[model samples]
Target: MTTLFDRFERAFMPNYGVPPVALARGEGTRVWDVDGAEYLDFIGGIAVTSLGHAHPALVEAVSTQVATLAHTSNLFLHEPEVKLAERLLALLEQPGKVFLANSGTEANEAALKLAIKYGKTTGRSYFVAAEMGFHGRTLGSLSLTGKPSIRDQFGPFATDVRFVPYGDADALAKAVDENCAAVFLEPTQGEAGVVPPPDGYFAAAREIATRTGALLVADEIQSAIGRTGHWFAHQADGVVPDLLTLAKGLGGGLPIGAVVGFGAAGTIFAKGDHGSTFGGNPISCAAALAVLDNVDLEHVRAVAERLRTGLEGIAHPLLNGVRGRGLWLAAVLTEDRAAQVQTAAQQAGFLVNAVQPDAIRLAPPLVVTPAEIDTFLAAFPAILTEAHHG
Candidate 1:
């Protein structure tokens, strides 16, 4: 028999490599393989599935909007898009303008353009970003990303960018100057094993950016949309940013991204500066609205506490400690065994991400049940033991 995975290898690009499992369907925090094996989905499509698989609210919103009006390009106005923009701004408790796109990379690309144009106005050309911080893969966003491993092959990048050590206020202060246009930082470094910045880092960034006349751009793609128990993770530090980029869980499962410009930054873009044809598709906007209305922050906080406490209680030699907040967490290992642990977990009917060689990331749905948490916790120790012994 020609399995789906076999067919996929022949037809698809090799960039993602070949996935071991082919998922056929999902509901809540559970998913089924093409062969009908069930597994608890803790990665949640790399933190994009907010309400879980096939939730009634998400399905209803997507289905209803698609049946009525799927897309209108950017040529026509739609109710869902307008309402979604307003809702996001309201959540921030700030007056801002929103530019919609289709993914996190696009959102960061848009922010990059805005920063460049703003730089022209102030006669500043250089940009500052944190080391190990990931913005996106697009050329514009890629230039701001500090990881050399990913950026090395794609050379001749924008040379005006400066890279500073993440979570170091003195380094950031030294890098940003009156000639700098913007400073990009992530409240939590998602790709770098769910690493969070040191305490008071964001506050210091804000003060430095203000003093140096640089725009503070918060890339909250992975940490926003209630993943960190807040609408935006930087809000926990009580600092307001000039620009914010968001995606991942924003559309609950649909593809959507947004760049929000606050205060004067909101008025930076003039008529016809930038646009996206499928940026604010009606279906995606409706689905995002559903996510916003249905997500219970109080519930998210409680489950996060339960999961964190359970993970910390595990007495295993391989385990070091857990980092990150809310539903976004990484189980740090004492050695480079995350890949083995991920395979062991999958074989034990659980899905996890080997975000780094020594860190396994666990980002479940916002609506993950206590029962699901208990099941994963109970099975985790055995899975770790198997990986350790192997």
Candidate 2:
């Protein structure tokens, strides 16, 4: 008998290839497919579900806000929107402006626009972005992204966008100049398989952007909201960016994106500059506020250490190393068999990601228990051995 997969192929767009499983329901860090096959959720909806699936707090917040007022457009004021913005600013510990959008790409596009508009006043016409850094898919943000395969066909991107090697302060310094409008980067290259920059790299980029009179925009989409045991990853580097773009884990599974501008960069937009119809939807903002309330740095730090020790403790060949901050980690495999490992793990009631050929990315829910980590660790060595030699 043809399953829902057949119907999915017949009805849905082929943009994402074909999803392997049809997840029916979830609770905490575990999910069950339509066939009732249970699996531990380490993907965390690609790191969007910060508190985990169907978290009680997130559910209550979303349900309450949705019933009260789902949306009022940007033309009207709402309590949830204002409150969420205020909360983010307070967490930032800095006075700035926040623009809410529906996704990380939109947030990035807004930041890019602000940078461009600011550049118009300063006589700068170019931008610098880190190579291998994943920004977003929108045309504007896509131009800022450094992946050639994603950009090569999407030609003539926002012109004068230059690429610099990530973590190389010298290359970044050389790329930024008086003519540069902004330097776009990530606190850590999360999509580049949990790659973190060297010590003081952000400081160097900050100094360069400041010296060159260019806005420094840090895309904290995958690294913020307690992912690194901090509100934002840049805080670890002690670098305050002129502009910050965030999403993924922001809204606790609800779609919400934000562009935070500091000091002068905050008010770069005048009236009628940029707007979003469903940006800052009350339901999404409420979900984000709940996540903010539940964010526990101490708990997240402990989880990170547990995962680090768990993965490192395994004395297996393929499972060679681990890298990342807090719960957003990558188990570096000895060979380019990450895809195979992910499949094998999934079949064994575990879920992981092959972010790259050699990197198995893991962004589990902040609510994941120590027992869950132990369970995955117990199966991980044999799983790697199977992928390696079996």
Candidate 3:
């Protein structure tokens, strides 16, 4: 019999493959499948649902804004967009400008252009980015991504970018030169199994960028908007980036991205330099503001700490260690059976990501509770056991 999965495979592009389960509903930090089975949603739509599923504040803001003014594009001005920019600047505590977009890739594209234009003024053409960092999937942003497997076929990419090893201060210093336009980094490497860089690495990068006169761009697409218990992940280290890109949890599951630039990078873009039709739509702006105002970040940060402790307390044999900060973390396995572990986790009524062969990344909503963490911790030992045995 031809099933729903078969139909999806036939009709859709196979980039993500056919997901095993189709969720019908979600509330708080939980979701239900078409068969009515419930799951503790630990993935949170790849860290997009910061306020959890179907958050009332987000729902109301989106609903009201859609009912009022939906989209004005970049040809017109809107209050919600202005308000969001102001709010973000308030959080950043810097003189800056915000360019809103539809997703993380779009934000990165805009940032790339801003850097290139700023470079034109400075007489620089080269760019430096960290290896193992994920910017996005669109061709422009994809070119900046350091993964060879994904970046291989999409060749003829602009040769302006040079890659350095993540968290390696000496390598970054060597790579970033006077001719470099910008240096891109991720506060925490999310797709590379939620890896955390060494302490003071960002500070070192900031100093290097300053020395080279290059714009320091921080891709906080996966770690911004309180995902790491700070408004921006770089804030934890007290470093202000020249260009900060954000998406993921910014709109609390609604699609929206932003490129926030500071100092000279802030004023580099003039009219018509970049624009997106659906970017900064009133509804998305409203939803983002609601997420910023209503999320219980204090509780979220506390639960994140507890999760770090609770996961390590399991002390499973196949488990090597856990890395990352706040709600974004990866349980590093001793073997390359992370795919099996992910499947086992799904079978066991949990949702986690095998971001790498030996790493399982966990990026639950910021609204996740202590009880929810307990549930995942309870199931993890057995899940690891199944993967190790299989």
For model 1, give the 10-residue run with minimal summed lDDT: 151-160
Query: Where is the poorest 10-residue window by lDDT in model 3?
Result: 152-161
- Candidate 2: 10-residue stretch with minimal lDDT: 151-160
Evaluate model 2: give its lDDT.
Answer: 0.91
Q: Put down candidate 1 lDDT per residue, 259-292, tens digits, no spaces.
A: 9999999899999999999999999999999999
Clash pairs, model 2 backbone? none
Count of residue pairs whose backbone atoms collide, per candidate: 0, 0, 0
Give per-model TM-scores: 0.99, 0.98, 0.98
Q: Cα deviation in Å at residue 15, candidate 2?
A: 1.7
Give the top-scoring candidate (lDDT): 1
Candidate 2: deviation at residue 148, Å? 1.7
- Report how far residue 125 has shifted in candidate 3, in Å: 1.4
Give me the runs in candidate 2 sitting further than 4 Å from their true place. Answer: none
Superposed on all Cα atoms, model 3 deviates from the true structure by an RMSD in Å of 1.0
lDDT tens digits, residues 84-202, model 2? 89999999999999999999999999999999998899899999998888999889988988888787788897557999899999998888889999999999897788999899999
Instruction: Please list the Cα RMSD from the true structure of every candidate, rounded to 1 decimal place.
Output: 0.8, 0.9, 1.0
Runs with alpha carbons beyond 4 Å of true place in candidate 3: none
In order, the Cα lDDT scores of the candidates are: 0.94, 0.91, 0.91
